[model samples]
Target chain A: MSKKNYIRPLDIKHGRIDMGHGAGGRSAAQLTEELFLAAFDNPFLRQGDDGASFPIPVGARMVMATDGHVVSPLFFPGGDVGALSVHGTVNDVAMLGATPLYLSASFILEEGFALSELKRIVDSMAAAAREAGVPIITGDTKVVERGKGDGVFISTTGVGVVAEGVHISGRNARAGDVLLLSGTIGDHGVAVMSKRASLEFETTMESDTAALHTLVAAMLAAAPGGVRVLRDPTRGGLATTLNEIAGQSGVGMVLEEAAIPVAPQVEAACELLGLDPLYVANEGKLVAICSPESAAAVLAAMQAHPLGAQAVQIGVVTEDAHHFVQMNTSFGGRRVVDWLSGEQLPRIC
Target chain B: MSKKNYIRPLDIKHGRIDMGHGAGGRSAAQLTEELFLAAFDNPFLRQGDDGASFPIPVGARMVMATDGHVVSPLFFPGGDVGALSVHGTVNDVAMLGATPLYLSASFILEEGFALSELKRIVDSMAAAAREAGVPIITGDTKVVERGKGDGVFISTTGVGVVAEGVHISGRNARAGDVLLLSGTIGDHGVAVMSKRASLEFETTMESDTAALHTLVAAMLAAAPGGVRVLRDPTRGGLATTLNEIAGQSGVGMVLEEAAIPVAPQVEAACELLGLDPLYVANEGKLVAICSPESAAAVLAAMQAHPLGAQAVQIGVVTEDAHHFVQMNTSFGGRRVVDWLSGEQLPRIC
Candidate 1:
């Protein structure tokens, strides 16, 4: 700390990132101490080791997940790349019914990017991590030439621990399982798209980018071993995630379109853009499959949590050799909910 | 597996990556199964959950580390980005005196890049993981539009475990401790620089990118609690890393330039480029600090390993409030080995 005091402070208000910030030299150290370290200060990071070392609770299974967030417009209506990066990986670990313990982030910044923007993102990330009760214990930063990279790409890795007797996996879904969703879909995708497309919606739509570990904890607590499969419907959205589970579990699914939750604003925006709500990405929402007997308790637990207040049983797993996902439309006709075939939205996180 | 079988085989021979490959849809799944899954097949990855879950050894401390690789030329004299990505994170975890167990990778690929080249990199990564006996259990991928990214950027996170009674940190270095270097410096930096500059030396030099966990294990076993600090001089090379250690331990250092190890070719290349060997990066080398009584044993252990065959005692820690790293040059002059000030070679990692 004393040694760092002698160096000039980073010009966060007016400076832009340059190759020196990533050279692993004095400028890099100065930037790290002034910006990143100041925001992510903790005992593990304070140790100044190449890695962070911590004690793990005995008998707990370890869960590890990673996500590369390349969302366009770094900032959106409800969230920015910083918050999304933390939430995305945190939810992935939570989807395994584990309690996220720590996170590690890697940043690739393009030269000429604003240091002010970088600081804002980092502050958002720090806030999100605090809200999720997960500390980012270690990280690395690099820089690429101006045209060689986007403004910034954040890659986050989350590590968590699951208590004994909790088993969750896509393959754990059974033919008699019931499917539940933790909130409205299409919000994140539509929000980002709206900003990019400059669509004027009747109401402002915000990205549902959030950490779901607490919601997951509540659900797991209510239906301990009954919860079978948990997954966040992200890039490919609900339809694709369902299809993946159906394939993994060797079963088919039947969804009641009317039971699925979608915000009016998001639905209207999707319709206007010719995008199907089912194929739109989500950041905070999740689809869970559990034993039929546990559906009521799980649903009750989810509804009690703020993040999952819109929880509902939207579908049921069924035995089928073809492993198809069919939706019973509100109009009383059934159609195959096929896997998303192409890019509905690129770099949508 | 059956669901993936129906998708058209990826055109690895002539096709290039498209936006759809990272859309998190059918194509994304196909790319993952055909390319990533096939290469990194293991039980943890086969679980197919949002994250990978595994049981940890009881009472063992956990070590987590991450690194972002943005090397130019993609392929260098001895290694490519893929292998470098694996080695870099693995070494970071090992620096904490831990045995690396698992890795998670996140790739950001520029759209329209060749699939064949991506396959080569992934295959090399898989090979490196296998060689190190570590499994890449979880990962993510994103595609940025052309001009928004270089060919590819990789971020890898490593998780490892350390047995009880193993204490290692940069702050552990004491004033009277001895400093040891694993091998010659500047090879990695000079090699990548040569490839980028198209320099034709009388003899080709290869990037010394390698995993140092085995070498570290040998040294730890030999010296036990006597080993105080360990670090790999990757980005800022020997000088910057040493400065960091000195600052962390609140001590100064005196190095014998005649005793330091540097390959003749690397020396000539650095001289030609007007670079200091101390400031040039090395991928496969490390610096260790230990008590004076344990130096013989630690150096002996390092010499026994092929990666550390050129290990030597190059310096000693000294008590100084200034925390300076001074070297007694072969020319009979003493000079302070300062922290690297600016970018010498960007993206040299």
Candidate 2:
């Protein structure tokens, strides 16, 4: 196509990338304007400032969180690194009951990384941020030598506001508190690993990567003062995050293995790989510890959200001096759900 | 020496490394107890929560920033990736005029990354943090396969409290704003380049790697409301950062080329490498845009601080139709300074 012919809105499907896309020139501006801004249409980002500026809401405190994404093969079967990065950090800040407002991304690109791929990832990140009602206002870019790094790595930082009279922490888990899972377990991990291992599941399972800030708001509205702890299972996954809470709060937990929600495809993939679904990662899921008196209310709130349709109460806290987590197997026997001993899967997030 | 005898702390140096140090059982605890905790003695870190929580002062906002370091040849003449990682994020948060309080470091290590080298970087980072009065409170560790990643990459996240009544931003610059620079430029860029290229200079230069939040605090104390913007000249260097401020504030600036500071040795190294000091990066320097009314006061305040003893007034902003940042050369010529056409020396940060 002639240059003028290509000046229209980007043809997302038929377009390949060139160096000018990352050149910080007119092409870069066009990419941001046509693809990214279109995907992430938010008021704060519309201002287009080098960095965002805003005030914390009255009677509220601000929370900030950041996460880095360097997943290989930028585009994955389930979700790209861009969407994963947005969801990862947004969930991190939301776990504290904060309303996310703005995000900043820093991209480290390898010399040969395709600009088309970067634009796609950037657009995906922008889409996720917009859907979550958050904005990507500021960003930085740097390129490493071709052999020195992966294709691209993105680090995103987000700022959020937390209303007053709300306090949540990993150490707040108390005995008798209920453990809640936002959705099905191991979907994200299984999806990404399936692509990596060149194996096919019985069904095509997309990774459940999403921002949980809105759901967190709903949960807070339901159980304002009863939410104990909130954490998203990332690297070492469900088993590791829960163990951390158990160790931090000095309390054990009992989980019903069968009651925990895991998709059949994820189960099959785990079985094929000889991996435990319980120990696999979940991007869009969260573990909520709530007071027994408010557990039902919180669950109801979660169920009302589209992202939390499969939310379930899978366990309850227990009193244990050693803070050992135990789970009731489907065979009606109790087994120790200890901290992850060694690496299960790397970079599953 | 026997196997047990070889485990002596100081004697177990300059070796390929074994598993004892990162096991997180006994030897890991020993490294923490004997070296790190001793060097970085702080109440919050001593208590050792998953994260340190403190009382956020009333009427103050908190700022948080995180950065990941994946530089090659981990060690160089003047500093290593360890010190740069800590100082980099702290400076980012401090550029907002916040008082840095705590830092969290997440380490991604290759399975065979030398334990001794790992210990050295940690110690350097710990010492740098302690010296700057910031505590290393919480951290995470992961090991990736050697071929999958570099030797080590350190991701540091920092949290700080912004004092009340202090609002600093790149957009805060206005017409008649004077630009003041602290210390010599290009030292860091030249130092890293020299070591990387094995180049020689009349005088060996050192990387200007130091925490600048204290200087920021001092500048605020001197002219709190007068300081409009503070920026560190990092990856894109001064020329690009100044252009950013100009674009953000919709003002133009004229830099006096001779008034800007550059060490002779650094200038020579840049010349040897075909790099310009104006576009070269700096770690320990900052760009301050303030009202002309308080320029002297801010300059005086910076000069009093050890970190800013060489601070100088470099330029003044003006109302320009083009909103261009130009430099008046020592030889009496003028030219427009633009945002880096591309990153100047990628990954120099």
Candidate 3:
């Protein structure tokens, strides 16, 4: 603690948030100067404006996405709520084949929360944003009464610029397109569940919460006009996301069970919980639908990326009276993979 | 309920939020389709993508703003959490003289909260957005267990487009500029406090929550480069905001307390609560700094707008050693109006 500074130094070890911290007063400014500004040191944010202003490139179209992360158990195996918040919104913007640029984060903190834990989380988030090349330009922080909120909830909004003539959407899929999986699924959901339940597995399960914009950029570079849709299965997992794509595109999908990538440990955890691996969440994996002609190129590009080493073709699009996503089982049977019917696990972002 | 529809209709009147509502399943889809999609029906949202994509106007720069609303007693006399969420971010973007284009809303729902209340809030938000000529392009919703969250907290991010050569910021306030206020202060804070405390005044106090983009546009049109800075007095109120501007601009401010507009009822309420009117919040009011030569035209333009009928010049920028914001009281005394030091009220927004 510096003797010259008038504001009391925050007891990072065991201090609780008081109402003055969020009252938009001197205490609030101290918190911002001491914690937030120190963590996210960016030029745009240093402008000290309520909102940031920046020049847009010529002929660039803007894409924006917002995701609220309310995951329980702030820390998980391979990720925490902080990193997941950055990855979730960045991936959302990336799904449109846009170059994610700026992000705004709003934190809702519960009083009595630990400052050391908050510092760790904020540092983690800063690292994630730095690694992804998307800066947290501006942000807001609010504290609620101890019992009024969970430990912390973060809502992140990302802004990206997409070049002209680069159109990608879920509705762009067609009957003859191919669906590719960008690695193993269900790691995030399984990891969180295993930690929550204190279940031990032979191999440690880790949440696949890495940012996927770079992977998307690689795929786009390889097959620009051939890519139809890029969706990261988060809350509803792979099966539900595929169904959403099918419904939006008005086509049916047939998946090959043998080609679907799943880690052995994730499968074991899902079995123990009686959860369907198909409906489990994956933070890092993505499903890319592309034209048949470009499928090979896109798959090769995805495989070349570090995040998609296990990329494989998992499904084919088909014409159907109803938009349905069906799976071909290893036993030579077909079952409609519908949207999840109930909550698999809450707060598993 | 329609007999042909297979999905069960939501019990808006008697139902409480369950885990399935936010599980990214069929039930979640049904809730989204029946409630949110039905309320916020727009083309960009109908695309059903993770993020919304849209074209930007040529030569237009992008402006972004985000705010998290966690007001207690979710509903008040003239507004609720919904309308506040829309207006808060919209005003933030508008303060920069940008035309608000789209908004992204994320809701954190507490388990066991009433569905009817949620519907009312969402409908209010939709109405606010529509009236402001801004559509909610995308959104995310999550649910937490009972006792873990307040009924609901909404976080909104707004994207706006600004034309070239238009730059408005707090740092633009220079010595010799005239400071004009849009309208009476303390309405929103008083209204919320009255409701929270169940106070009955002779005349009902109503929140001044409103979208101010059109008003700002009118002022900007009157004198484009003449305007220096525009700021909305929100959490820390007018005095705190002025202090921030002074610090940012490295100039001092001198205010005429008598010229500052305040409703009689609001003043009385503030007196009863032992709160300073200068520190009470005003959601719809704005402080605009402009050259003395252009102050009259800007004030006239602000007065012509519906939200700023009581526009008046209340202060002027001055060259001082400490960049202090001082007020000349009606009693012929001067006092420095410093930043708020402690909590007056929490979650008043």
Candidate 4:
């Protein structure tokens, strides 16, 4: 790169991506040095190898998670694809009861995509990583021909370390365990949907896209080994995620519709669009299952965090041979909450 | 998933990916279980969590590498995107002198992509991972609208561990170090190009796509702590990679053109297509820099490996303030081996 110092600087303001940007040549190097490396600067990335090498804490189990973000309208109400990419993977690792340590991002950019937009996304991603205390250590970038790709798609992979005796898995849930929700559902899905449909409401609906590692840490601190399972209801929303947990743990769940929190604006938007709030996605919220003895403490700890201010007990695990998730409606009727049947929305996250 | 066992199995023979497959619904779950899980079956993945948690070797530094595959033709002469995706990231981690342990794959599929083709790719990916002794422990799948994506794009992230006292970096290249080539160059790029152009020859051209971790292990065993730098010349081929190392190490290099190996068919194809072999990518080959004292043993070890049978001494590190890489041509003239200037080929790997 030093030898090519005489080359022209990238025109980030007016330039558009082309085939040369992904050709693995001088142009690609220049883009990396000027855009990605500049934004994701860290000691590990500065090593400038094909990968990043770092020391891990001794005797800790490692957690790995990956996500592909293809949210349309790269810029959304409260978050863009950039921050969503980071938060989505970070939340996944956090849901495994681990502290995220590093991340690797791969970008698939379409030819003719705006460099300015790409820069904005990278900057947002870097900010999100910094806030989450994880660095983007290594990444790869590729460009597809025009019409072959929709602007850009990002895939982020996260690595984290779990402390000793942290046994968290979907199968860990037990009968009589208490189910807790960190916050309202459907904010992320409704926010993105509103943006896509050009729908406007009296009050704006912003995405609840955020990193929940700290909230998980707080819950873990409150009840070290009592928490059974942790999961974020991203796609298929809360209903599908609960069904998955039920099947995994070989237990049924009973949910009280009145207990599950939902913002009035999001509920209204969903009603207008004929979308069920139960099947809507939430980027920052999580469902945690714990013993009855620890549920109070975990819920309190969650409510103390800014991201989990609306935390509440939403349901309970039940013993059922069929592993069905049943919901008691506020109208005094019970119904089976099955997995999301069809496409409620596409590219919601 | 057990509760949803009554759902129809994915029609692997004559189905196309639809919006529901990525909508985080029953269709998505069904596809994941019937296709991805069945093909890349493993205990870690079977945990059925948002992420995979595993214990790492105590007191070893971890290495992470990522690559995105968007090759034009999904199926190439010697490999498809699946095998290429695995070998690419595995080799990147190997170049760091690390033993790869686990992998995570993310797929972006276009709506209307053939399920049969996707199954083939997934099977190939699973085979490659199994052969390389690494498991795809966690993954994500996203589907874009038809015409929004070109068939499919895959991004694979690899995690590895390096033993203590093994310090390998591009900046470690010192003046007077011996440069070694693992085998012939341009096989991967030329093979893919020939397939894309519908060109044929008396001898078929096959991509040299194979995991190099075992070969790297052999070289390390023979020359422990003697290897200075290791790199796979992928995109931009040998010339561009060498120039990158030169800039990073603040040194120059001198190469013997005649010593570098190129297959007869590959050379003929390059000549006929007006392409430079030095700028064509090679997926299975590697370039190693080591002290003169250890070059002989290291070269012998590489040659003993099936992947590096044509190993030879191709160049030597030189001290030059300009950091220029020059080669002595067979015609008795010296030429500067500059970086790849433009897009010679797009989506080659």
Assign candidate 2 its CAPRI class: incorrect
Can you tell me the DockQ of model 1? 0.84
**Candidate 1, residues A1-349: lDDT per residue as tens digits?**
4664436678999999999999998899888788888998888888887789999755468899999999998999999999999999999999988999999999999999999999999999999998988999999999999999989999999999899889989998899899999999999999999999988887999999999999999999998899999999999899999999999899999999999999998888988999999999999999999999999999999999999999999999999898999999999999999998878999998
Model 2 lDDT tens row, A86-184: 898788778866777667666656666665676778878877877787777655454456555567667776666667778787778999999999888
Q: After superposition, how far is residue A96 of candidate 3 from its true place, in Å?
A: 1.1
Clashing pairs in 1: none
- Lowest summed lDDT over 10 consecutive residues: which window, candidate 3 chain A? A1-10
| Candidate 2 deviant stretches above 4 angstroms | A1-51, A57-62, A161-165, B1-68, B101-111, B136-144, B155-167
Q: What does the lDDT read for residue A82 in candidate 1?
A: 98
lDDT of 1 by residue, B1-349 (tens): 5764445688999988889988999998988988999999999999887789988755468899999999999999999999999999999999999999999999999999999999999999999999999999999999999999999999999999897778889998889999999989999999999999999999999999999999999999998898999999989889999999999999999999999988999999998999999999899999999999999999999999999999999999999898999999999999999989889989997
Better of 2 and 4 by lDDT: 4
DockQ of each: 0.84, 0.17, 0.61, 0.85
Q: Please give the distance, in angstroms, between residue B294's alpha carbon in candidate 1 and its true position after superposition.
A: 0.6
Best by lDDT: 4
Which residue pairs does candidate 3 place in steric collision?
A: none
Point out the worst 10-residue segment of candidate 2 chain B by lDDT.
B1-10
| Structure candidate 4, residue pairs in collision | none
TM-score on 0 to 1 scale for chain A of candidate 2: 0.88
| lDDT, candidate 2, at A59 | 42
Runs in model 1 lying further than 4 Å from the true structure = A4-7, B4-7
lDDT, candidate 3, A186-291, per-residue tens: 9999999999888888899999999999999999899878898899998889988988888888788999998998899888888889998899989999999999
